[model samples]
Target: MLLVKKKGQGVKYGYQFLRMRYIIMADILFEDIFGVKDIDFGGKKFLRVSRIFCESESFKMELLLDVNTQIYPMELGDKFRLKICTTLREDGKPDTGEFNQHDAGPSRADQFEYVMYGQVYRIEGDESSATDTASTLSAYVSFGGLLMRLKGDANNLHGFKVDSNVYLLMKKLAF
Candidate 1:
């Protein structure tokens, strides 16, 4: 875990009221997200996603995707990708903490860079469906660029705006 020493009383006060923040670097692999039921959060309903490269030993986790807001949609399954960094834990378990404010630094491209281009095969739930011969869609996009493209059936064509700063690291590394 990463820690910052307090320099003054204000720092101590902040720690007492605010939570300590940290970031975790690890590999993330998309597995699947098949079952989707409801959207309890007043958005695009809830979906179950299967992940293999998660830092957590549990192996699988679910995220709530707000289809309405394209800014940061929860990992719907193997469909969504991950961008991570590395840090050590006291017990030896991988420290996979959320990227917090204190963790801000240079862009991942500055350290490493790459591009990921793949077809979005499926989008489980009532939202959308997969199309085409491979039943897969092809997309070519740069990790540190502004727009990522998704190509498939004209009916299924779409684009997702990525926050390069947040996903740049994981996008560069191969799964």
Candidate 2:
């Protein structure tokens, strides 16, 4: 159940590589449709900074994120699909793990209105964290100090691991 998409028709890896199989259904590490519940909670403020709290549509996960509103403005009623993935390559190739602003080629980030590159720095479990489900887990990511906390079930956070390079892609949903 981890994402490890490999190319080559009619090919398979050894049992030792089962953890890195072709992820047909789940292309990315984590995905959730989040509805903005509140903005500027506690009046926490800094120049060009706004903290937005959101709740997931399907997994019931909660996200408290700090985004630079100057670059990517979000409204009080904004609903978006937030995705955390290992690679931005549409072909599923892993990222070079280097920062190359002029990297040639089309990326998955092109379709999204907002994107950020970050890493999963921590993960913890809290038995009482989730009210709806029995499972409890949380993944913390930082996009250059703009932090994100995703808390919900462990199954929803399957592929996430510490030090994993990730891309946060967001696209607004129109009703």
Candidate 3:
């Protein structure tokens, strides 16, 4: 609910009587605004894990890849490529009249799934970043030009380390 107070709308003020009004609304989740996707509208990007830092339970992964203003995979470093595709927009929306679902590329079934394979460059866990207690644990994985942050329990992220091969599986919630 939202409440607005007028200049004279107070209990001390008499008639014209003061009135208090409220506007009610439902809560919204963050995922609704940014839907998950694998290959975004921008052209494909190949990246290498450059650095990884863990602060308490939260971990940050850095990658060496191209950066595009149309889409942001992660916090781009000195390395970066931009391939503009007329069919799709930065937000993953088709460019209306110019977009053709069937063109030249992988089929929808093949590209619909979200899976990324990469070698972990480095990893720091609770022991290195925590002093007292740990809260939420997170893992950041990058695929080409895409970046994904996963939050959950730390036990599930076992075996991730420097030069270790890792597979990140994600679900496409929206087109």
Candidate 4:
């Protein structure tokens, strides 16, 4: 349960009343609302690929992601919900890490328009923030060379691990 100050309802004084709201635990490893800050199309170096810079809406995380523009295109100012997960199975079971037909059953991927399977290759703490041991960390993953670097607080990125397989799900937010 998260003790969050209820919005618009407060105590007798000027303080906001603390309200209890339960968070349901699920297979979501990490989720965030991100806005595309800028895009660097690795022109000629990687045709049909764009290196997009994004910043989180709430957590303020920074992301440098390379996407295959030929398959999934993202333009400037595009806001999307990104979720990294361990499985696409609806039952929360571990994925076999194999490309399988989606006809077996309903999947978490069913609700997502874009999905990619990737493996975490690196995770490191920010040496600049050495005073605060777990201040910030970066996780790098690769989906067949399309790379992603997620940098944020260690607490918010606890579930990530080097060599762990993960699925990236994304859906554009309609604003």
Tens-digit lDDT track of model 2 for 78-175: 99998888888776667776758777578889889899988899999996655655677889999999999998878888888999888899999997
Ranked by TM-score, the better of candidates 1 and 3 is 3
> By summed lDDT, which 10 consecutive residues of candidate 4 come out lowest?
15-24
- TM for every model, in the order presented, reads 0.20, 0.80, 0.29, 0.80
Greater-lDDT candidate between 1 and 4: 4
Q: Write the per-residue lDDT of candidate 4 for residues 1-175, one digit (tens) a residue.
A: 3243456774333222222111113457789999999899444357798899999989999999988889889999999999898888776666665656765688878888889898999999899998976599999999989899999998888989899888999888999
What is the model-wide C-alpha lDDT for candidate 1? 0.30
lDDT of each candidate versus the true structure: 0.30, 0.84, 0.32, 0.83
- Report the Cα lDDT for residue 96, model 4: 68
Candidate 2's TM-score: 0.80
Cα lDDT of model 1 by residue, 80-101, tens digit: 3333322223122233445554
Cα-based RMSD of candidate 4: 7.8
The candidate maximizing lDDT is: 2
Which ten contiguous residues of candidate 1 have the minimum total lDDT? Answer: 49-58
In model 1, the number of clashes is 5
Off by over 4 Å in 1: 1-105, 115-123, 126-168, 171-175
Q: Which residue runs does candidate 4 get wrong by more than 4 Å?
A: 1-26, 41-44, 98-103
Model 3: lDDT equals 0.32
Report the Cα RMSD per candidate.
17.0, 5.7, 15.7, 7.8
